[model samples]
Target: MPQGPGYATDLADRYDDWFAPPAATTDATVALLARLAGSAPDGPLLELGIGTGRVALPLAARGHDVHGIDASTTMVERLRAKPGGEKLTVSIGDFAEVDHEGEFAVAYVAGGTFFELRTQQAQLRCFAQAARRLLPGGLFVLDAHLPEALAAHAGAGAQTVETANGDPVLRVRRLRPAGQRYTSDYLVFADGLFRHVRVDFRYASPGELDLMAAAAGLRLRERFGGWSGTPFSDTSGYHVSVYELPA
Candidate 1:
């Protein structure tokens, strides 16, 4: 099992309030996912790291049977408490290694969570697992930021993001190019208290990810700069990539 404190059980209570919020980009992402799912041939949809049902809930509401896997039990419990969350079948375990019964029409990981695997080998395992769980010609999608863009922030940096009520949260980050990793420490002050959180990510180039997919028996199908079907180019800062298993 993958061991980590970054996504521990304690973080579940604040996970949604801290990260899940409706935005124009969020709408676009769901729209794109729903569109891609429409091509699937009647099977359950699988979400890797389905935190608090942010995307899964909305997709389930659209009449799709959605299942998910996450390492954090607390997060899954919180998801179960939501109004439509109970409709989702979630297993609490590391998505990269967990085995869920039944083949799926589509499997996806959003918010660059794929990088949370920490190592290239782990990521490969995740791809292989997704391919195993998907039916032939089934889709495997990923949403991630381009690592090339992080070159602009090669050193230490800090940014302050405010909440809906104007409460400020400061994020301090550092980049290590040699390891292709980024570390972030967040200081949040809300409800008259302060909380600290830290997260680490290992990013990979698009080509590297494509190679991993190929090793997992998946073939690249589509690549977009954004969820709106924007063409991917050298200037693109993020990507929504789709792959398919051989039929």
Candidate 2:
């Protein structure tokens, strides 16, 4: 229900380059997700916010049918331009409300995209939709950074960093603890011009997320600090959580 300056076409074109050094995380992410995927079922695997097929294409290469839903047509178009990308069935729409045929054995969102939904109600709707899209006992996986770190920086105003590509980017963030919302405004200098993008995130603690998943008929099954299966602890920066629908 909440939307802002979502992934723009220009930003989509530079996404891969901006996140270069994909080898650092992409391989591990795909490997762990593939393991979690287990044996392929009759239904295709589903990826929410499947940006540029970063994880989906690799999974599809492993012979599992893969479908994706994303709100960015530019991102989907970039995915389509890749080798073997044409094999994927990607729909352009909000992953939270998009309708896809058949049930999925596994559904996931990577890179903290789950937090992009700016309201608890919308997030709950997403969980319900995922439950409806999955077969009984199907898996739902989420990868997100903990809010504790951001909470530490409440009302810190603007910060800037230079990308590896020599672009200077400025970020301004405001955190609202009462609603567990974090809003970010990014200004990126590229091609001798500056562009702005705004993103609002609704973050939940692990326990809160479990409750939301339960409301949607999913039970927590597994959780880890990272892709290597490290145990989650208070000091952990991010978490990968898996939930299951009742069989």
Candidate 3:
């Protein structure tokens, strides 16, 4: 079972594999942030728990100023190793604890990082700190998995996929008790060899997320089923909700 606090430590070495994206969905949330950022500071966007530069550097490449903070030095170090990462700025600190003076046009937590905070108090503090990083009328975006998809896979199951190299892939799933964590086991067949890897993520419901945003004095502006503007529904697999810092 994966709890909130030890999540980063457990995921540190294997972070890249879990988030390893082939194409289409990579930084899918970025498009929404760019769109919602309209009429805001445009000064610089702040990313909470920005991992591996999935969205930060790309946003910077698009000519928007970006800054990010993460608790894992290992994650930040890996981000710094990436091409665009070397040039981008990242702070090695907790999003809930780190204090920055600059007001941002947009502050976001992508790839489900928002739920890593675990407890309601910590989650609320994260929102409070993140909101303070934003200027008035600034936008705060958060992406998380939908409860239905998780409930759909309540039991363990497996799927086979191929990697970019045409290697066979086997993915197994198991939902932890209370729906607080998900464990995925992946077996890869490459070079006529097979190796198994595992991944874990802490889960949060949409209602829990809404309450956290409200706790920080931020209003839920809109909720989307996916990064591509799908309307939020119980059946949707994931969510992308935008919040306001009480302009």
Give each model's clash number: 0, 0, 0
lDDT to native, each model: 0.82, 0.80, 0.72
Error of 1 at 51 (Å): 1.0
Which parts of model 1 have CA positions greater than 4 angstroms off? 3-8, 153-156, 162-166
> How would the candidate models be sorted by lDDT, starting from the highest?
1, 2, 3
Best-performing candidate as measured by lDDT = 1
**How well does each candidate superpose onto the true structure, as a TM-score?**
0.93, 0.88, 0.81
Candidate number with the higher TM-score (1 or 3)? 1
Candidate 2 lDDT trough over 10 residues, lowest sum = 1-10
Flag clash pairs in model 2.
Answer: none
In the range 1-247, model 2's lDDT, one tens digit per residue, is 2222365455777766553224547788888888887843456789988888888898899998889988777888889999999889888777788467779989998867899887788788889999899887788899887888776655566777445466777778778888898887878887888788777789998888999899999999889998767898878978999999878
Backbone clashes in model 1: 0
Report the C-alpha lDDT of model 1 over 83-139, residue by residue, as the tens digit.
Answer: 898778888778887478889999999867888888888899999999999988899
Error of 3 at 90 (Å): 0.7
Pairs in steric clash, model 3: none
